[model samples]
Structures are given as C-alpha cells and as structure tokens.
Target: MRKFTIALDAMGGDFGPHISLSASSKSLQLHPNLFITIVGDAQQITPLLKKYQLLNHNRIKFVHAPETISMEDDPVSVLRHRSQSSMLVALQLVAKGEADACVSAGNTGALMLLAKHTLKTLEGISRPALVSALPNNRGGHSYLMDLGANLQCGCDTLFNFALMGSVLCEQVEQLSAPSVSLLNVGRESNKGNDTIKQCAEMLSATEFINYIGYIEANELFDGRADVVVTDGFSGNIALKSYEGMGRVFFERLQQAINTTWYSRLLGKVLNPIIKNQLKNLHPDLYNGASLIGLRGIVVKSHGSANESASFYAIEQAIKEIQWQIPACISARLESVLAERDCLSHE
Candidate 1:
C-alpha cells in the first residue's frame, strides 16, 4: 500500500495530547505505511510521547504549535487571531500538500472556518457537508450528510448535498451506485417543504443518482437507503436525538439487567454480547466525520473522543487516502455538473 502522511491536531480535543498522541501510536502500528505529524506545544507533547514511548518511531513526528483554539473559542475570532494554533497549523499541512489529510478532535466551528479559509470548497460544490456513517439494518453502513454544516440550505444546496453524498458513499464505501433518500416527516411526495420537494424533483430527474425517494426519521437505520441527505438543521437535530437515544437505551437496558441477583448473573453471561452491540452503536466507533466538498481531506473526530475513538478517526483518514476519495468526488462531480449544464442549455 502507498504511504500516507497525516497531520493531527495534537492538543485541541477534550483529552488533549495524551489521547491524540496515543492514537497516533495505534494508527502507526496498525498501518506501517502511515506517518503522522502531531501539531501542538512541545512541552505538552513530549511527556505524552515519553509515556506512550512513541518518540523513537521515525514515522511519528511533531511540530511546535504553542497556541490552541479552545472549545469555547469563537470560530471567526480564532481564525483572525490564532494563526499559530495547532488546529490551523494541522489544516495548513494538508493545504500545503505536506500531509495527505488532517484529523482533529477540536472545535467544530473553528475547524470548519479554518478549513474553508485554507482549502476552499471543490469546484461545483456549494459548501462542505459534515458527513458520517451509521450502522444500518443490512449489517453495513449508511452515509448521512449535512450533519450540522449547512443549516439553511436551498433546493440547489440540498441537491448539491445529494450529489456530494452519493459520491461519498460510492467512493468511500465502494458502492457503485449508492441508493439515496431525502429525510422527511412522511414518505409521501408532497410531505416536505418547497425546498425538499424541489430537491427531490432534481434528484429524480438526475439520471446518475440512485435516488430512492423519501424516507421518514423512523426509517433512518432500516437499510431503506444507503445514503440519507438532509439540510444541516433537521439532520443535526435528528443526529443528536439518535445519539442521545442510543446512550439512554443502553443505560436503561443495563439497569434492567442488574435489577436482581439472577438478572445480574445473566448480565455477566451476556456481557460480551452486550459489549459487541454497544461497540456497533458507540460514538467512538464512528468518531470521524468527513468534511466533504473541500479541496483536501479533513476528518473531524468528536471532541470527547478517547484514544480508541481518535484512532478510528486516523484510520478513516488513512482509508480516504488509499481510496483517493476527494479526487473521485471531484471527478464524479464534474461529470454530473457538466451533464446537467448541457441539458440546461439544450
């Protein structure tokens, strides 16, 4: 396999250097062809390096970025003032072609702002969408886009999302023609507002899209479609609600299992099975959210990610690198747009 160099924001997450640097060690071990440059304060990174015993590995290196953009930092303000911050520096590595991709567990708003300023969106893409995969009924994954990115998207913006989302599902998941759905309240054609209705029309007319019509929120994980496209507003609400439900469901399940001695004993017997199910739904397993439509690859790990979660993000970036995902999206996008433009004029 071809080697990939990753630029990691080493000090920005809730767990700081310990989790991020340790994740680097895990990634390097898993992929021998991978190289990582951890961007953060030398003072903070060195101890973690020593603790993890990762300094001697030539594939792992560091760049001193003394500043950090905290979770509470204003995205616009950080972009203007924190030029030397680890988040910005790490993104810069990807823009400068020094790194194949950048992975961060940092301020989401700040990362999005910095990425747009540094790399810009791809040609024909209106905006970058925050996308992640979720386990579906088919024992495979479904891609959801505009997770919290474009809050108030237009019909065209929603159309762009479907285009980007379908390409993403195809490139990353190796789906030849991924089935896509527009998330809405009802499955009827007339259910959604003007934007979604019109967007659906566009999707239907597009010969390239494997458009599967409307899907309700309840069917999100039913394997009804391989990809779900929505504006950031509703998509964000649904995503958070889904995540909250998963946590609450497992907590309640555990409580019920421990209600009595016999039940507790049964719980222990079923512990491994429960753990496996939890692993499938765990936020850590799906920690990385790809910022698609950008000129370079950027994977956003959840801010609260631990070592394993952070490693998942790194591995995601490595896969994108191996697949040349961005290039594939760009090529597919150019074809789709060009074909549309031709029909528009004709």
Candidate 2:
C-alpha cells in the first residue's frame, strides 16, 4: 500500500481553529493510515487538538508556521513576502514532494497563485480553472468549471474545462462519457452573449466532449447537464446565487410556519423530511473545488467551511489521489493540444 501524508492549512478559514481542528480529527478517523501535518501557530492549534483528543496521535504532527495570510491579503504580494504563512507552507510541502497533496479553506486566489507558482501547471495547460461539484435536485451531482478562477475565458479555454471536467466526472463520480453542457441564456444554438455563443459553437465541434448544446440557468438544478463549462465570472455568480437562494428559500419556509399555529403543526409533521432534504443540498457536501489544469490535486474549500465540510473535502482529495486523476487528465489534455497544433500547422 502506498502511504500519503496531507498538509492541512490550520489557519485558513473564517471560523479559525475550530473548523481546522474538527476537520483534522474526523479525517484521521476516516483514514486510519492517513498522516496529517497541521501548519499554523501552536498557540492557536495546540489547545484545539487537545480538546478534540487528537493530541496523542503519532500519525499527526504540528508544524509551526509563524506568518498568517488573511483573506484580504494580495495574492502575489503575500506569496512573496509571507514565506512562512501557513497556507504557503502547506503548498510548499506539496511542491517539494513532502506531501502528496494540500487541502486549504483559504483565499481562493492565493491558493491558485501559490500552486501555479510552486508546483507549476500540467503540460499544455495555460490557465487553471476551479471546478466544483454541486448536488442536483434530480439525482447524484453535477460538475461545473471555471467556478471563479478566471473572470474571462476564450473558446479554447472553455473547451479545456469541459475536457478536464469530464475526466473528473469519470474519476470522481464514476460516470462515463458524461453529458457536458455550456451555460448560456437559452438552449438554442444562437443564444447568450457573444462569448457563450462562440464557445457553444466550438464545443459543438469538439470531438472530445459529449456536448449537450446550451443549458439555461433555470435548468441547472434539473440536472440537464453533468458537466457545465462557462467563464469564471458568470459561473461564480450563478453558484453564489444558488447557495443564497437555497438558504433564503428554507428560511422563508420556516418563517411561514412559525407565524401561525396551524402552519407550525404542519411544519412539525414535515420537519424531519425537510431537514433531510436541506442537508442533502448543504454547501459542505460540495466542498473542495479542484484547480483543474494543475499537475497535482489542489482542492479549495470554502473560506467559511466548517469541520464536517473540511473532512469531506479531504476525503475527496484522497479519492483523487487514489484514482490518479491528475495524471489521467494530463494525458487527455496532451492529446487535445497535439491535435490543435497539427491543425494550426496545416
């Protein structure tokens, strides 16, 4: 059996040590052989480890990282200046082959910037996109890419996201020739902005993808597409809006019930079922957006991720490693890039 040690950023999220401590403790239980190196100030993490009763594990080690990078810090400047920041140290460990991969609930931009600079991108990959899996109301989950990494993307880049995301779907979701869709204003061939329209045309022509034409925003939760590719700006807005609306929808439902005794009785009757449904749609289940196009697995958890979310993210990372997803995607991408180069020569 191949052994792997994960480097966790102990001071990454908004909830601070509580989230990190909980994630690490639960992760150890999930993978008995899994080793973790928690990087952060001992003053903050040591007590939490004790509270979680994880202070005695020989497989767990704490590495003191003096500097901490806040969410507001500039990505490039902090990477260069704050050499000892916990997030940077965790990434460096992976870059130097000290750890198999890194999991961080930190600034998304900083994680991308640091990973690109340190570990470098895979062959023929220009810009790495953040790809995430969201729970579909229909069944299972759907994967979306360029979630927020690049604000704008070209047709070729959009195609790459589809190819990369397809590989992820196969490796992680255990799906084959998964249906790929372009996020656009309508399902028609000639809808959406110029960028989306052009990308749709390009995708339609691609031999690599199982392109299902354009998918409208309303169809996102309907599971019309297994892999949706779009520019980061649009994708990010759509994702955040879905999350916000999901919360608001449930909140209003609760408020409506609490306002009346009759409605409250109905709520009690359906409360357990509704709670289970909401749990299925929670953001934590969809934690860890993969930085596709990178040479290794780099998962970005929500900056506000809690312990359970972090644990799931780590489990996903472990699956990626076991499946050798990065290596598989690299081979497919090389083939695509080669074909493009041949066409350009003609």
Cα-based TM-score, every candidate: 0.96, 0.93
| Runs off by more than 4 Å, candidate 2 | none
lDDT of 2 by residue, 128-238 (tens): 899888888787889988889898898878878888999999888888788999988778776787777777777777677788898888888888799999999989998
For model 2, give the 10-residue run with minimal summed lDDT. Answer: 199-208
- Structural RMSD, model 1: 1.4
What are the runs in model 1 whose C-alpha is more than 4 Å off? none
> For candidate 2, what is the total of clashing residue pairs?
0
C-alpha RMSD of each candidate structure in angstroms: 1.4, 1.9
Candidate 1: how many backbone clashes? 0
